[model samples]
Target chain A: MATKRIVVDPVTRIEGHLRVEAVVENGIITDAFSSGTMVRGLEIILKGRDPRDAWAFTQRACGVCTTVHALASVRTVEDAVGISVPKNAELIRNIMEAALYVQDHVVHFYHLHALDWVDVVSALSADPKETSRIAQSISHWPKSSVGYFKDVATRLKTFVESGQLGIFANGYWGHKAMKLPPEINLLAVAHYLEALEWQKEIVKIHAIFGGKNPHPNYLVGGVPCSINLNEVNAINSERLNHVSKLITDAMQFVNQVYIPDLMAIAPYYKDWGAIGGGMENFLCYGDFPTHGYNQTDSFKFPRGIILGQNLNEVVEVDARDPQQIKEYIKHSWYKYGAGDEAGLHPWEGETEFNFTGPKPPFDQLDVQNKYSWIKTPRWKDKAMEVGPLSRMLVAYAAGVTEVQDIVNDTLARLNVPVGALFSTLGRTAARGLETKLIVGWLKGFFDDLVTNVKAGDTTTFTKEKWEPSSWPQSCEGVGMTEAPRGALAHFIKINSGKIENYQLVVPTTWNASPRDPSGQKSAYETALIGTPIADKDMPLEILRTIHSFDPCLACSVHLYDPDGKHIHDIKVV
Target chain B: MLLLNPEGYMQNTKINTTLILGIGNTLLADEGVGVHVANYLNQKKLPDFVEVVDGGTGSFVLLGIMQNADRVILIDATIDGEKPGTIKRLTPKFSKDYPKTLTAHDIGLKDLLDAFYLLDTVPKVILYAISIAPLAEGLSLELSSEVESAIPEIVDQILKEIE
Candidate 1:
């Protein structure tokens, strides 16, 4: 029996291009390799520029992760300059980030990850009435009428019958791996559409706060929008009310549609609870700080590290500690002035591209050599998984009452133990649970903002240390935040007011990075092992796990055009 | 995954608009042409109906903005191998009509359109895909002379369409 090697290049329905190769003997995967095929020389663009303007550049790295990068970037400069944002600004930033989590997680579940589970073709065979019944049964979300479901099914059917599947074209539909009943598929599809429309409304909070959506404005001292209830130019009462309404709507959508859908879908994929539990170590740079950015104890998510699957105790994480987080290019397409064998802390990190050796063929990856454009990052020389699961587990471990309550309730409902929280199912469930929790936090933050505003703290920006003339000659700081995907950090070094060095260790770099010097595979690769591949040609199972990480590789492959050709499968090429 | 709806902005303006969205990544050379054209038209004293927006990569955030308009005219770069600066106008009836697989980002344009359909507010979608060469340079705002030259012609074409 020979081991069959399979590869899914440019995994669809993700933020960026990712190539995964796996060796499957019999039906189960034995070994896996993850490669991020795109290289974003964002740091190169940031060099020799004003440290204050870094967020605007880094924010362009991903269309989906627009605000997270901008937030991280602005915080980096602020941390370097030692500026404390005003209370209003802090509250607004937290509200914006919380809003992003709610929106990002919902989109990931329905639009991105839903297709991996709910088969669109199977959805056509669904009974709309049954779908409506299930929808009504799951949660009291409005618009679950029979007519609504019928209309959705009819539209889906029309689109399918037109012989043009479009976005739904390449789905591994009707695959044995798709376990949901047709009615449930239809239900998921309806919400998918609703989520799309609903998702668009959540970013209005960004527009009102930061003045734009995709690339919002961020300042070193504080947020961009000034708080003024009377003035038209500033964030007045009208704009604030609009934000308040959006948060309320987000809370409703999360509670009614998202959580209910997760509960309804989990029973069908319980076996997934055992597989895709790759690493026991989890890391989270806790976010949504109330006191100050430096106050980890005040963070809603709680700053900590869980080592070796230990949930009872959480190890403290310090981003500035050179010994804590170090990046290695052992199997990545990068080089170091210090050494390749040893990892370099991001401040000492080099962005020199060294593709000097003989190149592997375009399609085939020589995993033995430098195979990925992503650098391998490890916490204390150990590969730790990040994202919703890590944050939830950390919060749960730290005994955040809401997180603990939700996790326990969910676990009890699903009848799964704590160990299940590490698997693919656990990872997927964690995203939904945290979204519910984050929406509450958003509302809380929104109320806090309004209350503070009422208390006459209308300040949103600060001119304190606004000029670099008051700065030390050289300083460095690691601005860490837990993005929707995972722990995100931007390391910055400022010398003479110019950006002496800038490096972004994004969430994907931790989860999607290739094996390190010690040959320890990162989250994606390790998770894929032992998973059963139902079909060689269609690797929907692989997508289920990888999409769980919400990979944002930052694309660079718009070199050609489809020319009206329908891309049907995960092209091995 | 979310909204940045300038509903308040729309209310403040209080004018029915034929939204013209120029979509692309401005950081990439030709990929940012749509935004460049949009920024160009935005400065011009166009008719009240013409509302130009820089729809960066055309994802869900722009959906709320797009939905606010009565009709939408999307201008973007298309690499259909026709020529470096060939301009092609399309009234995309289906997601299949959009040239996606090899273009800037996956066809979030088409998927976004399909989502619009489910909402039952499918805006009159008109796409002007300006053909450009495969992007080679990195971290550039300068469009190639070929693509750059087509901007005025494309702008004229859009203006004519609006009229």
Candidate 2:
């Protein structure tokens, strides 16, 4: 009957610094505040630099989704200069992007988000033989043998016995909220370890194409890797074969392990299908361009906005229309030139440090004031949720038969209604389904790339319009992509050959933002409202919803601190 | 058995290549010290078998490169409640020996080491942890003066490790 505030600062297993405060009344969260505590002056650092070199610097925004920033940065420059990349280059970029999606989603599901569901300590009690039986019953993955599971169980036992949990140290093991039985928990634990190894093999595609993973190389006009049948250093026949094998391996794992694992785990936690569905409006700047970047119809994932859970009428997304996508910092820790209440288009976006909240180690945030470094980015002044769930729902609504079939089949299999597809479990399931869809598309892209190479089309870069002299004196461009977390856009204003101003509104910035001038709560905050907290102290339920968004504050807000001395230090355990 | 190829450079005749990996964000002030030290070492004429890579906050991707090497020297920014620029060199035998948190990535290099340990492919690892102030909200590309001065010593420590 009493209102109590519970805060989870620096939510572990997420990419960057995030602090969440929720006021719980009668074991239900009534109000919530999401804050991104750090500021990365990445946009500030990009000013006055050559627009061509922007990818190398901007790619450092976050380490996990490394290549997405590079891709978006190069695309931004390309869009500004009006350079159409070669078809071969387009196919190669698509494949690389697909590889990143598979790798990111798999890692997110197993390593990052899975711990919130599967209790690691409970896995020690699971019988290896029973776990193996359940694993085999679910999926046809080859490592589902009792002997293999026994070995995995032994390794996990040793880890638990060693007293040092390492990455698994702070998890709320054996919590009342953990739903999985010991056998299923052991099965998930086995797959979690397998996924770590599986991810390594998938990233080799990036290394083969871009010369490295994490921060892969990208060019404005085209990709950097050239297809040469004879050269050892280039993307030759031998390397292409290896890339082909890796795609097949990734596809098999997604189909055999990832999707099966999601389905197996979804039924147990179907209650989550009714929780954490925030800001039903969804936005996606469709990706995987078949033609050039300008042609939206050629995109595999079509660009659109699905508002208020209305799956029937899908509205077209116009990134160029300044009114459609504007960031409001009314309640964010940023000051706008026009005033605190005014919304600014990213081209005219400004990053001014204005920390107007209580200092660190505080009990509660001044929720009515500036609370987060992330500004509320509204699509036509409406808070829009962007991620796999949004993308999948939009695709399904648009009658993309593949997306529709996957969503329908998944819901049917779980025996949950269509309305249930809008919650936290739905978000997690959507990521798995999207990975499955992307892996299928990767095979087609790889085949198309091979076909282009066989036709003696070795062209990868367009060198004609690369020089600054060939450009207009002033131009503005918006580069948008469906990053692993969600919709990511980078806006660039170029003068002569240099970047005059740059603004990036990443995916998490949309989902994890604070309140706007209209006093509307962010997607994360809205999702947290009415979330039943089983335990106020452990608050694993709050983490379940937040982790579902796959929050990456580094990508959302770039740098921290204007004054070098007063660093906000909050002790996180 | 050093041999000269067409480029006429002395190549290391040793079979096992020692990878010197510098992992951090170069755009972040003191956090980029490992990359700075790596770049400094890259300019020097080291052994051909000694490869220098600026990993730049990469997590599992570095495992492929790490597994290929017989030994590795990793340099990154670490905060252990030490002075801002105090350089600490350690030979970490297990993942627990590595710092609990890293500046840029959530699953730090320690997680990667744990994976390597699980796979039984972990190489001999030596770390040069240049102490930066603990994770905070400040922005600068230039390293603190103390961190900048420790670069030579850090590189020296890495050179000694490889030798």
Candidate 3:
């Protein structure tokens, strides 16, 4: 049989413009290429800008995870100037960060990644009473009554009969790849609507602390919000109480609805546990600092590297070490000062355009050459995978009791072996487990905030090194944190209080990056190499593995054009 | 409970302010036209009831802002196979009324509008689609000369809408 190339340009339901090309031989992908089709010069724009204002601009890298960039950017400047925020400020940031993680994970599972698994059309065939029964068997979510499922079924019927699927239009409904029963599909559909309402309420936490949900205002030294129990205008007792309540609500959803649904659905797709395991080397910069930023022991998520699925050894990760973390653009559409093939540390990173691939409307990418806008970031000169799976595995290997207990409990419940944690299903399950752990941490952080406020320590800002005049003439710092997606780092070079250079190696870049100098395929490419294509036309299988990583190519690459004039339409047909 | 206004100001009562949201990435050349237009509008002395926002690329976070507003004017880059700087005005009642391809962050805005529709909180939405060349590389903070020249006209159009 002749090898056919399947290309899915502008992968739907993702954060940015991405093109995936797979070579199928005997209905199996033999080779794959993941290309970030956009390029925005954020690093170049940050040059000569005030270091303090970097967060506001850098956070624009992506619309989905805006807070993560701002958080990483502030930490980068704080690390450079040796500024430690007040304990109260740390607590507030932790609460806000945890809120983002919970909200982002839930949104990803339902809105962004769910349709890849649950067939929306099949829900119309579901018996609402049976769905209600199934929902009750899992957990005690209140919206599981037969009447509720019946209403949801009617809504699904209306949406289908309307002849306008809206968001569900692009889904490969009734495809052979979809394995969920109609009753289970109806249950997922009901939860999907519930999640939408739940997310809106959860973001109130961000609004309470940061003053906004999407693009929250952040100062260089501390959060923009000042805690004041007496002042009605400030983050008073009323608002604090509201945040606490929101956290409880979010935790209930994650515990009762999200985790139970994942467990119930996992049994139907156990075969996924054997597929989409790419680049066994995992990386996480460990986030949620309980103490000062410099104190590594205080981080709930530890920074380390687990190589080759070897749970026995965990290596320490020093993000600032140039020799340890470097980016190569040999197969990317950029040139380096050292040359095209040379690897440069992010501190010394350069963004120069050099598009050598065939122009758009072209059939296939020249995968052997420069084909993507994403730079291959190598950790210790190896392509490592980063995300919830990486964070879970690293924490488990480091013997984090909380992570171990959850992982053990989840594996035991699923009746799957420990090795199953290396596959796509594990990646998806890891996100749910991580969310459960973070919800617990969020409750503790909220309690700590309340305790601090009651203790009369309401200070949220430290203006120690805020002014440029009080700074060293030259310095550099690396801000590393575990974003909801994976490990995120912001490298900054400051000269006379202004940013001389700025570079960010986001999570998706590490996972969805193109080939590096060593000619090793990226995590996305390697994961797709052996994926069995039930139907090349449907390509649901491809979307399943890709969506497992929750690819945010917009955050990975900068912009979406190689030429200055031509516009390529994303044709769904 | 106190609500955070668009300007980060604390208001005693909920303000049914008119939101002028510019959604796009400024670093992506012409794609940032909406943001540029919003910034331009912000500089001008506008009515107290109008709030100009540079929404950037974050879509979900803007839902609260949209819900708070009585009316909304969204400016973004759209590719309708027209001239690079051609400006098209649309009052999108449904998500389907918007262009199929809305720059790189189409899902954010399109999906957001759908959510608003489902919740029945959708305000009167007037979109200014600044048709530009398709997304390709060559990143710049400056909008294309053609698009830059149309800013005054676009601002005037928006001013008239609010007036």
lDDT comparing candidate 1 with the true structure: 0.82
Across B44-163, the per-residue lDDT of candidate 1 in tens digits comes to 888866777777764877777777777888988877777877888888876666776324354366667766766667777888898877666345657889999999999899989988
TM-score of 1: 0.94
lDDT of 3 at A103: 90
Give candidate 1 regions above 4 Å deviation: A356-363, A555-573, B1-15, B101-103
Per residue, candidate 2 scores C-alpha lDDT tens digits across B34-145 of 8889889989989877888878878877776677676788888876668888887888787666664444355657668877766657688877878887544545568888
Candidate 2 C-alpha lDDT tens digits along A74-106: 999898889999999999999999999999899
What TM-score would each prediction reach against the true structure? 0.94, 0.94, 0.94
For candidate 1 chain A, which ten residues in a row score worst on lDDT? Answer: A557-566
Q: Which candidate has the top score in DockQ?
A: 1
RMSD per prediction, one decimal?
Answer: 2.8, 4.1, 3.1
Q: Write the per-residue lDDT of candidate 1 for residues A42-160, one digit (tens) a residue.
A: 67777889998888777777777778888898898889889999998899889888888888899889988898889999999999888898988889898999999999999888877
Report chain A TM-scores, every model.
Answer: 0.97, 0.96, 0.97
Top lDDT hit: 3
Score each candidate by Cα lDDT: 0.82, 0.82, 0.83
DockQ of candidate 3 compared with the true complex: 0.37
